[model samples]
Target: MNSKKMVLIGLVLTAFFSSLAVFELIPGLLMAFLLLSVGIAVTYYFALSRMRLESLAGISILLKAAKEIGKESKAPEISRQLGLWAQRLVKSEAVLVWWQGEWAFGDEEFTAWPGLETAREWVKNNNEVLVLNQNGGEIFSHPWPSNINSLLGLPLMVAGEAAGILFLLNESKRGYFVPQDSEALEVICQQAAAALNKARDYQEVEYFYKEILFSMLNALDSRFPGFTGHSQRVARVAVLLGSKLGLDEEELRILEYAALLHDAGKVFFLQEGLPGEAGELEEMDKELSVLPMEEHPPLGAQILPDEGVFARICQGILYHHERYDGSGYPEGLSRTDIPLAARIIAVADLYDALTRLAPEEERLEPEFAIKEMKKTMGMLLDPLVVIVLEEVERELDEIT
Candidate 1:
């Protein structure tokens, strides 16, 4: 009962029992009423205090989750953190969060959790939170854990679009998630959605920037007559080689960008009308690829944006033409002095140049290209990179 109603009831009991005692009708009954009233009042006060404390705790946790979510900028990392927070917020045994991808937390052995997929679809279609509990629903018909009779599914909206779904499953003696639990989760989802949108925006901007860079690389390819798709092919091979060599994601990314832009420097020195068709380059212009050593590598490095994330990529490009035994271009840096990305790109670049369908004098048969690469392994290319290249070639051969 509400505090006002309880108070009125207590007062009425007080007067009723006191009247009996005043007439000496039943002093014992008056004593019993006094004890009962005091007990009820104390119990009511503690219950209210407990509810207030629980509410405050939920608010505090929500704020904490928001603060942590704001600190992450990567989509995957943000999803992970948010999933963890949701699990904690609802004290759920398992939480599933889905954005561009999905993450599951807690004990996920319950494969038969009914209505999960349906709930996801329902939230997506309706763009609203849905709660399922055993209070009066058929959703709990499926055999569930003794304590897990409720599911709270909230749609994570980003920029007016449903970006993801957050599910909280109850599997404890706490009975089931109540309406207040859903309310608290809704507040947390608001913050999570904002963070997710911010991270997604950052990702989209990065992707757009990379797209422009790729276009510029393609334009550079058009200038080299027979090398139209050389950059992209080299990048693909380089990524494959980098993976075989155990390069981490960051390293592979740098290698891919460098492979695409490795020849960007040659664009500055092309003679007029030199970039027409295959074999259109005059004999004199062909010599420019080898001569003027410092020009292309350093020039390509200078051509790339050196102030931000591309700086390392520029380094990779600058050294890609360097020889493994200190006999190559620009810096003549040998072995370990050459960046690993440059080493991997060098192998990929040379392999593509030899095997791709270029001029009659330039292109080599696939078998011949492999033989030629093996011949130059330790002298012109890093031995480790060449090994990865061979692995990639073997895999490709099997696929063929």
Candidate 2:
């Protein structure tokens, strides 16, 4: 029968016997029997009530603990929360122990606890929870402190593999943990395992994304001559200039992207039209050279997606060759009418080209290249951009 019903039946029987003794002539013996029975029933009732209350309290503690654990996204936070909850539930100290390829607790650096290595080895060997008695006196039982007689350990399992163990200790020698206590702890461990796995998966996905982006950049480099290291260099220079110009993070990112892919449209341009071939151009070749040069900027714009940062980069690509005096092709936008990214790239592209070798001749001496750049400052280039280039040139010389 249910405990409540059994308690009620005992109380009723006690009352009936008491009434019988009181009404009968044979008084003393029956009266003593009735008093003993009534005392036993009352004591049993109180004990059962306390047990029920403790069970309910245990359930409430676990529910709150599980809810808090569910809300946490970090492993250290989870461990701290588990420690706090165990302290509150059992009125004692607790520790959360985890093992991967190595053992650890929270985000703290790993240190070997005296018995932990042994515990971990045992779990790995047997794949089960280990509970020990007090006094370190038990063989075939997990170890517990003499001061804290009760100890409970629950295995954290994922896919039937032991991931870690949860150890709860009572400072006062409460009786050994009941089956219900172990059951509640097991549920908490299950939730923790799931959370850890999710974090691991997220980290893996992030690494994969970075790998993919770098590989794509490498592929683009392989297809274009003299373009292998160009994008990274441009990005670095653009970011430097963007910082000097007091651009915000978002603006800096756009400038960097534009610089990296400024010649992306050239991917579609004829290979023979590269700057290296400029010296080899025959009189008849001028027509072909001019055609590809005129088409690249617009074609680059068409190659990328039509919105956001990519679109902005495309706009920059389309106009990087445009001149300040309306002499440039595709569109003759002059001076401030051109986008800032295109203006910045115009200076960078020219500097790189002038300082590098081409098919016809060796790269120009720095002094001669600077003089040529100064000549075109207000007509072919933005006057401010020319000033910035002069400063950058000085810095490069100092570093060299």
Q: Which numbered prediction scores highest in lDDT against the true structure?
A: 1
Model 1 lDDT per residue over 1-400, tens place: 5666766777787777777777888878657878587768857776997899997987898899888876666767776787788778767767777675454333455434555666666778788777777663553344555667778788898767667888877765666776666676776678778877766655543674477666666655556546677777878888888888887655676687788788777666554343345434333122112223356778878866674456878888899877888877778999989988888888877777666634567667767777877877778888888876766676644322
Candidate 2 residue spans exceeding 4 A from truth: 1-26, 90-94, 106-110, 133-153, 168-184, 213-400
**Model 2 agreement with the true structure over 280-373: per-residue lDDT tens digits:** 3222121111123567678766766665345766777788877887777678998889888887777666655565423336456656766777
Candidate 1, residue 174: Cα displacement in angstroms equals: 7.6
Number of backbone collisions per candidate: 0, 1
Cα lDDT over the full model 2: 0.62
* Each prediction's TM-score versus the true structure: 0.50, 0.43
Question: Each candidate: RMSD to true structure?
Answer: 14.7, 16.3
Tell how far residue 344 is off in model 1, in angstroms: 0.6
TM-score of 2: 0.43
Identify the candidate with maximal TM-score.
Answer: 1
